[model samples]
Target: MAISLAALRQMILAHPKALAQGLSLLVLAAAYSPVSVLNLSPVYGSAATKLFHRYGMAVTAILGWFLKERIHEMSRGRIARLLPVLAVSIAAIQFLLFKLSSWLGSPFGPVITESFTYYPLLALSIAASAKLIQYATEISRYGETIAEHGPLIASYVVFNLAERISEAFISKVIGSTFLLTRYGLQLVIAALYAITIPSKSLVLTIPLLLLSYTSNVHVPTKHTTAVLNERIQPYGFELIDRRDSLTGYISVLDNLNEGYRVMRADHSLLGGEWTKLPGQYNPKVKDPIYAVFTMLEAVRLVETEPPRPADQDSKALVIGLGIGTTPGSLISHGIDTTIVEIDPVVYYFANKYFHLPHNHTAVIQDAEKFVKKSLASPTSPRYDYIVHDVFTGGAEPINLFTIEFLQQLSDLLKDNGVIAINFAGDLSLYPAGLVVRTIKHVFPSCRIFREDAAMENHPAVDFTNMVVFCTKAAGTPIRFRNPVPADFLGSKARETYLMPKHEIDASAFETIEKGGQRLLKAASVDHIAAFQDRSAIGHWKIMRTVLPDAVWENW
Candidate 1:
């Protein structure tokens, strides 16, 4: 031990910059990996940047500045070997840190669940940064020709580039198995230090490192449904199918107790349908679990002057196909349909699990891009009805909600056409107000309705799912024609919710708070982002009620 400690001390004194460079790389990896991991969790995925950016950045900066001297002094002592241990510990604990959620619970649970791997790894990374700063200061005292801030500047540039590259490529490559990828990269970082720094702790770390690799290997995968099922089946949940994909972790889960199946992405549920339990099998269309989706179909029922032609003659364009409930309904009615969905895996699972009919034109791509391209092309098909239902993971994609995007969607509609948008947000918040105002701004006549039973009181927080039905005819009021029985398509969910219900006063959103009527644009996305923290936290609590704790924790 003494000999190994002596060797590590010699290397630290001789190669402090070399060590700092390595630590800089380690710090960058540690800083970014957690963001990816948090994205997998339903609680943090929406507001991850806001949650960690403020606190983690402050902690890193403060520790790097205040502890440089202490870190420098400690480097010469026997305790220095333990510094590398901090890096290794991050990968080790994450294998089971999610279990902390049961003890911690929502709001606080997510914060604590992330803190386990985030802070320790960050502290160690800061120590490495401190070492570089100290070495740079010592060199400057002798007045040697060195770019004092050059190392940091270069490190910052590389760190940003790495962050961007990982966001673009690495995340796409890692997909849904990000849990294992995150830990695997962490182990690689630790191994880099152990191998390069040459510590005697390798005797212990080597075995533990091997064990961590194995533990990570057994981490969930598409093939490991049985393992996850073993933990969640007792709670009446079955993992039907799951995969890592372009958008997020896409999975099909069946709540056996409730006799319903839901398609999930990260923490948010895309959509679900009531399943055929032993006594409740329906040979016709399966009913939807959420009324909002069924309500969206009311876009077809919007009354038109000269009375629109039969359903078979009208064309429908659907953006964001969630389990294909809305579009599938459109297809069932024999309407020509085009679906623009971002994730192909979502499309695949929706078809495979939810029985999405294969008759529609599935343009598997981003909604915004698809709209822009369709608008640019003179030959693009115009739609009689446009359904926009992109809300997922507790937050709306702000870009899709912007005025420019909505105007493009408006252009895609015929003069007499109608559109329905499914949005989930707290009506009491400024962001939701902005979205409502923006939709109203683009579409002259519109009506908003909530999914569930009406809340008697409009409190400080009213988080709920709603559908907004709008029309291109400026002066005409958006009214739903009385539905004939055929409109229900044999779905009980439709019979009850096929028409928009629990009407929300559009005027209320127009004049909400100060400038509440302000429209949302591409530049105003940040304004909405600033307020998502509270909404995301509330959404997490709501999700906890939707699924058993075991489903989320096991994932």
Candidate 2:
């Protein structure tokens, strides 16, 4: 019963057309698979759990349509009828997997949730390939009808690709243009589909479209004057400009009657001190809980005397510049300060509204990239002080909190240099503990202090900010030198902020549990990803008090 090699070769040569048709279908299935995955990205955040179900149904429907055309024996009605059942089955399987992943305490929970879309697309691709194989078998028995429908098949393939491309384009254009008026666009989409589709199909689609529309409608109207007056406006500021960045909100505010102004990022209360206040000034606050802005003043205090001719010009490197507060302060004290700010909006707002010191150089780049480049070149002068104050949404940048990043800061600093890092978070959380441990691992000497000790000690009552001071040399006590009274008030806005009432105690750091583990310095991408989701949730809750939920929701 064994077939000879010569006979197999002859048969294969005789049915080259069928083989080619089957190969083409397989290629189309593969192409569609990746496109289906790409389609999931936009829906990931909004749909989250339901994304898989929706994409699975869409893929199944598409595959069913394709199969009905290819398999002449199957009626379109029969194939279409099976789509809902298959889609449900796929969704059930994905849901179970998602639940299992969550129960296992795996970091894969989000990935599994996202995979709902991917798995269904994969199933559809397999189904399409199976249908193509069946068609090839039928064509061989029926003397090959595929050749006759070649043009139609090609046109269908082109149409499917065009449809996907058009759908994506329309989705983006509509979503962006009608962002505030999404309900109207949803109605339009529903109406168009209703007019073109059969009654039964329209009935199913309209509800789905409505749900999708409702899920995505993000209007900016859920705001109150109480939020503006109590939380934001009472700071003696009026919001002149605001923009969303990859990091967070960057806003600029001006004093109504006075020439004073301030710039801020969401949850980043005060970045650096006022450099260009209207008149001469003295800081009334001594022993201030060093925020990102005031921490830069440490550079000015590092030197007991003016710079000698032999000494290199005192340079301060600031990793995250919110409103250019620290850099401005450093520049005022005659230090050559270089600020590296990743967000252009923050930089723009600082210069425009905050009246940032005009003398310093601004490098608009990622701190990691800048550090790496500076490290490779030995010619670059080491900084006298490095202020690492890039906090937003009540969480420190996990990447910046790593030991590798801290070591880079150490490399950039002079022998007597000091580095102050501003970290804002709940000390009880694993994120804060991990960050402090990481910093301690990198720098030999470190001191942790809260912005307000009274607030921090009351664990039941959550606090917003904390700063960690670290230096290369061992046993260097954290101190703020030469306290000056507020001489020239920049603005009423500045006056309200500059008054030092919040006192930080070193004793608060004693309560921070290290969890009986030695400090670890290196953190991989996985380490960061593991903590991000929980940290983001914690940050979201903290930020609600800083700004109204409506403001964050609107963004």
What residue runs in model 2 are displaced by over 4 Å at the alpha carbon? Answer: 1-292, 295-299, 302-312, 392-394, 454-463, 485-517, 521-525, 528-530
Candidate 2, number of clashes: 11
Prediction RMSDs, each to the true structure = 5.7, 11.0
Best by TM-score: 1
Candidate no. 2 TM-score: 0.55
TM-score of each: 0.87, 0.55
| Cα lDDT tens digits for candidate 1, 402-458 | 899999999999888899988887767888778888898999999989887656776
Clashes of each: 2, 11
Write down the lDDT that model 1 would get: 0.71
Candidate 2 residue-wise lDDT, 169-189, digit = tens: 543343233321233333342
